[model samples]
Target chain A: MSQPGQGLSVGLFATCINDVMFPDTPKHVAELLTRLGCSLTSSPAQTCCGQMFTNTGYFREGEATVEAYVEAFADCDYVVAPSASCIGSVRHQHQMLAAHRPALARKVDRLIKRSLDLTEFLTDILEVEDVGASFPHTVTYHTGCHSLRVARIGDRPQRLLRAVRGLRLVDLADSDICCGFGGTFCLKNPDVSIAMATNKAKAVADTKAEYLAAVDNACLMNIGGILHRIKAPVTPIHVASILVQQEP
Target chain B: MSQLTTLPRDTDGRLTPAPPPGELIDMPRFPINARHELANTDQRNNLQAATATIRAKRALRVSEVPQWEDLRQAAKTIKDQVDRHLDSYLLQAEQSLTKAGAIVHWARDATEANQIVVDLVKATGAPEVVKVKSMVTQETELNEALEQAGIAAWETDLAELIVQLGHDRPSHVLVPAIHKNRSQIKDIFLTEMGQYGTPAPADLTDDPSALTSAARTHLRNKFMRSTVGISGGNFLVADTGTLVVVESEGNGRMCLTLPQTLISVVGIEKIVPRFEDLEVFMRLLPRSSTGERMNPYTSMWTGVTPGDGPQNVHVVLVDNGRTSVLADPIGRQTLRCIRCSACMNTCPVYTLVGGHAYGSVYPGPIGICLSPLMRGLDSPIDQSLPYACTLCGACPDVCPVKIDFPEVIIHLRHEVAEHKIRDTKPHLETTAIAAAGWFFAKGRRFTVMTWLSGLVGRVFKAKKQFGAHMPWPARLWTSARDLPIPAAESFREWWRRNHERP
Candidate 1:
């Protein structure tokens, strides 16, 4: 693992999904970092990790998006994103996607080494599990596939959740299987996707937890969407939001 | 024999070759098939229960092997070596088998392979043959061809027998009739087994033992009388010309030993260069496939066993698009598959929709890569197979040979898109992706689009917190799960208002 630069400065990569659909997630990420005594900065030039295009098989478009991303975060000490999917893309896919461009690939490799998912940045780099947050609600965490399998950020989010004051963390069955929000896969094959989502929703409901929290909002959006559509009692919340919660 | 004359055949007494193996298109697309399958509660339940049970057993068995990972790597390395030099290995296998008194024939495709089997059967002048469960035979649609040639092929494996009697496609590699529960098996047996061979008892029940007993009684008579036995080889040892069949039931053993003449149809990729390589595969196959520490019956024969096994031994090495699969550097890795079916058993999509949706003899994660490469991906069903996965990475995780299914799926997706581009079709997805790519290529453009989408999303907001339904292309998403409405304020905009720029 790369060492954090002097004085705790980090670049915020508010992944395109969060930037557009769940903007509050990046805000909470920022707030949580601030509470952890880190200085945060955002580049207006940053957009996405190009995961959408790459995963959907548009390599040319994915390459362009990746190039833009690398250009945006090239000089940052450590780039933090609230999304494991985006961080996973940057860390795993970008180098492959940009392999044709040797210089760009090298830059992506460097950026990937420095990139961290939100909880990863907190628990690993910041060395702070508890960020002085309080959320008194029964919650269950669904570890997104990329986070668990790719980024290998096992139990980091759960560890932080466990540290939250007044929070009751419950276990979700088969929490590691995908919630079926596989970018275009959900739309391309909705029946299978819906069946998988229905299973996930049932598992979440079985937990009887008031909130279903995960690192990736895209998964939450899918699981949360189904939960809301079926009028399930549980609601989806981002881990960053939960981590940044105060007495109120 | 009465049923044979109605089917058309050539003047040479050969059934007209079926369409080239991979070219038998027009199968329903995956989503369409999955839709109907999803509605079949019984199939869904059967698949869920069977796969879950097998998956647990497999995990436990695999965990018990302390050197499981090393064994998997060894298997992968051995298979990789085999694939890398398949031509030489195949020649070596042929030479070794011939030296051991086995007649070896090379089949370039399914049609030629079926022709070889039929001609070999006709030479025996036998109207009936017992078959061991072989995926290669299924891949070639050999039974249909043999029937066309006026040969009665009795499926001897219990699950394969159930599938044959029910007139159903094999839904899984390991358990051919996994979609059929005990009751379904009893129904198939009670109704159809009599017409084929020995009839089931009038009081046959859905109990597993009863079902097996019925199958045993039905197959036993055929096994006794059949002069020819047909099978699919699981592994072909190139060094000694040994063909190995790893199976649970004793049916494979019966088909191997009972008949005077035995023919094994094997995919060329099934070759393992060295006999010692079997050690790796033996350990991996059972644990990965049926979740057994070891399959109950493992039949190995090097040519004719003289006085013990069949006096006439013939092995047909079938290509059937395998060489085409081998030509692809990335896709050829799939050739390493030992047909453990571990990937299918663990795949979430396969578990839900069952194997019929894949529209190929092979299904699930391995099928997604194999079918397209073998069939040339021109068919709509084949094209859609690659997208059937959620890319959950489970299949690769459990793959004994470590085929990296998601990577292959993604690679094939690219090929499918390229194929579309070659056809000059208007792809909505391509257009939307291009537009998104343009937006992301420039930060200003991306920020503007994000703001616009957010504004539009808020404007169309419904009473529900998330958009209950969306229009057109987006409607695909909303049909199942609600699409989360874009935030009212873009994060960049919020950042502009509150935070200092870097």
Candidate 2:
């Protein structure tokens, strides 16, 4: 493993959903970054990025959330979030919020330049293609909505996956399509949610791979839950899980 | 904040009157086949041919202009900057309209907005009104409200007339009757004309011109008779207080010109600050909507045009839930929409289910965002609208305004997930994610959880079904789909056993 001096001094933004709901993502992200010689620290105050309140039409709440986000990560060199939703929010929404809330604008301006999703940070910044991990399994990747559309993190995950030894990357058809997990949309519209999830589940099943990996865990969980319920013999793992892998 | 009105609160503390189509709608079990609409093969063929022909024509027309993308970008930027200062723009729009002899009424939701218009018509002492095709009116169900008030509201657009006469809702924006074939339209025209006034000949055949002629004849009397004209504005210029409506049919021109009193219901987002800005949008709209180089009749009226048009013009600027949408930073981009329906034609999901499945007046990719914004995320139907997409980038590709639809969708999903966590104590998703976080945090726990998952997979081995074994909430998965059982050994276990020598 490369020494910490050569590593990227990445700060994990472990967005609200991943932090409170799935903290393991950040843990894996930190481990993977370490393997790539990325020195990492957890930003404790890096609470919810306010993506939720902002997108739901709560402007004042969104502003407050943006303030809290900027305050938490203001000192970090780089804010790396596990969620494309949060990273996308910081990159896109923060600038808009800055216009309305002038006091917090500067912080947001700085945050935008440094903020990135896990895949983009690892492959692009660290220049680490394949980690020295060996797991001979055929894995298919499902691209999350925000990562692909908002952040435009194209081919970064694929590039990282290509470098993994013994890991055969089988491209899932229509992989860039959403897995139908639109957060509150699922609860409000469970029927449509299932329809979207079912279609994504079918696509994942069609790939005939042992593992289904992606940069965003939200999509994975939705697809994984459906696949798990349907008994599709595929495991859904985060891209960090594979990228951080080391030989025994 | 002082100039802008806070959305009035209801007795329940939520935004008042609730959002439209509030009732729960079950998600379709399977994909809605376009073939179901095949019974109207003539209509289907007409729609397909029309859309395709227009699409090609638009491509040709647009290619001639080297500044097309430049114009689109300028429009988007203007809209973006305006939306950022939306509160000020709305205030300015209201002030300008009020200054120009127009009364401005703020509606918090659709019901309140409809009631305001119905009351406005009643006060005018007019028993009938003529209308142009306006999405805002459709959204507020203004025509239905007028009928409930015992006032007859006439649709002037030939296609809108067909939809109204046949007791059907509009399927497409520009051509409301795009889903109805020529023969079906001829039947509607033959039957409904006499009830309204002019009748088609008994020998009239199902020809497009014959149907149009029948409609023109039937609507002529109402156009001349109605004292009040109800309309929706395509663009309400805040600078000069000019409202623009672009249409191929001359009916809109008649509605504006013939009426004594004109009232236009406009959404808050349609405001363009200046007249010159119309140059950019005017070109983009027709080319994108009808695929025409220019609409045949482009009507522009400012307040009262003396002897030229209606004597009294009242522009009702509606807030509904638009202010709420504007409040959202990520979602604010949706306001940049020009309503060209380019997204609708290119959408794979929309091409299949068409508009009705959306269960809202606004359908397609735009509908998904608009409905939920107009409504709240609380109702089953409104909530379900957002998921009615595959998140393909096709909608964004064709967008003249370049509203990133896929971005808006994921942003909406983030809202949905956050709401679920906040509103409830702990749901299945939260619990499952929480558990995953615990297990995946450490190597030992990860190994143990993987083992447990493998064991559970084994239980379904006999039946080849894992869905049957899932607990409640998670059982929503097996409701329609079946899961394949897991292998006896996991990838990790296999890797450990065989690759140890490496």
Q: Which lDDT values do the candidates have, in the order given? A: 0.86, 0.70
What tens-digit string does per-residue lDDT give for candidate 2 at A13-126?
766545433445666776666666656666434446655545543444556657666766777778887777678778887777668666678778877898988877766666
Task: Give the residue spans of candidate 2 off by over 4 A.
Answer: A1-248, B1-69, B86-116, B171-187, B203-206, B406-419, B422-444, B457-482, B487-502
Clashing pairs in 1: none
Report the CA-based lDDT of candidate 2 relative to the real structure: 0.70
Which candidate wins on TM-score? Answer: 1
RMSD of each: 3.6, 10.2
Clash number by candidate, in order: 0, 11
Provide TM-scores for the models: 0.95, 0.64
Fnat for candidate 2 (0 to 1): 0.04
Writing each residue's lDDT as its tens digit, candidate 1 over B1-502 gives 1223232333334332222233335787888889899999999999999999999999999999999889988988998988888889989999999999999998999999999999999998888788999999988989888878788777888988888778677899989899999998989889876666578999999988988988888877778877899999989999999999988889899999988999999999999988898988999999999888988999999998768879999999999999999999889999999899999988889999998888898999999899999989878999899999887778888999999887888889889878776677697777777777888987888889887977876796664364545677677677767767677788988898898545
lDDT of 1 by residue, A42-99 (tens): 8888888887777777888888878778777787779999988888888888888988
> Best candidate, lDDT-wise?
1
Which RMSD does model 2 reach against the true structure? 10.2
